[model samples]
Target: VSGVRDKMNMLGAVTDDGERFIALTPNQFNAEVAKHFLRAVQHEFGERLVIILDNASYFIAKTLKKQAAADGLLLEYLPSHSPELNPLESCWRQLRDGRANRLFLTLDDVNEYLSTALPALNSPQIYEYLC
Candidate 1:
């Protein structure tokens, strides 16, 4: 649940490999958002890789297809209403329900909290859960 409020954009990425990263950007749901997620994929798995994504308008199947074509990636789509199949969904739930919800304040405050939470989530123990 990446969201923009008060000109601040909060975006999070959690890979099946359990390498989670989040960013604070001024542009919400823009090319930078897509690029950030794609960059994480490349960093973890290189250029040629397959990634499953939920059906979000910003990261829609068509948009992913176009981005994949441009980047030479293989983006896969999971069925709607089946978020359990996406490991990132669990990560998002953790962040939103467990972390983000508990510490909701100004946008800047949320971004600050996310900064600390994201890197901490990229541990081997957390990665195992994704597997």
Candidate 2:
């Protein structure tokens, strides 16, 4: 690998019909990355989409909301501590659990793992994780 880094963030979302979107951020997740990811989602789903989010600091940023509003998308926050209400939460939990006892030698390793993991999650069966 060309370089080593401590953190990588995954910005992910799922639609009501179980479409999954994953954006790999170079570093820690922040409002900027959040906004960029939202823009891509906007491009995919177009206007009037309501994105359900957890209260991560970046997701709640005023700038992100303004951008979403301008794009005709609405951002709604799930109640605190309510991961179950977020459909993507289950996929994230699976990702976490799958890697809980492992270490990746490179970012490519992480990417490979994500590639392998996504197919199982891209279907409507993702509700199993929510339950």
Candidate 3:
């Protein structure tokens, strides 16, 4: 999951069976990320599928609705202020506790650590913890 500390922006996504694939972007919450996420899903899953998102910004909601309408994708938005409803929040907590909390001398080091850590998060065994 991605959340800007100064803004009420959080982004998260998971597979139909609850596999986490999330990121914390430096960019602000916007339609662009939603569009990119759709593309990423297409790239990864091939078949267009319904996506779920939490309502954070109007821009994201508008952009997601537009893309879903245009691309024949289904989009569902969870009720607001309910972080626990999103399993990816647990994953984010794990990442923050495990990797992001550790100090690094450089952005590259942070990137490298996240690059190594994210894939390990995808393991089915970890999903149990999130649940």
* Most accurate candidate by lDDT: 2
Q: What order do candidates take by TM-score, descending?
A: 2, 3, 1
Model 3, 1-131: lDDT tens digits are 35523322335566657566555666665778767767676666656676666776742577667876788777777788987776677667776777645767666777777777777764234345336
How accurate locally is residue 97 in candidate 2, as Cα lDDT from 0 to 100? 86
lDDT of 1 at 69: 77
Q: Which candidate should be chosen as best, given TM-score against the real structure? A: 2
Q: Model 2 reaches what TM-score against the true structure?
A: 0.82
Worst 10 residues of 2 by lDDT: 121-130
Q: What does the lDDT come to for candidate 1?
A: 0.63
Residue lDDT tens for model 2, 1-131: 65657566787877767788888777678898889999988887776788878999999999989988888887778899887777776778888888898889777888888888877664445555446
List of clashing residue pairs for candidate 3:
none
User: Of the candidates numbered 1 and 2, which has the greater TM-score value?
Assistant: 2
For model 3, the run of ten residues with the poorest summed lDDT:
1-10
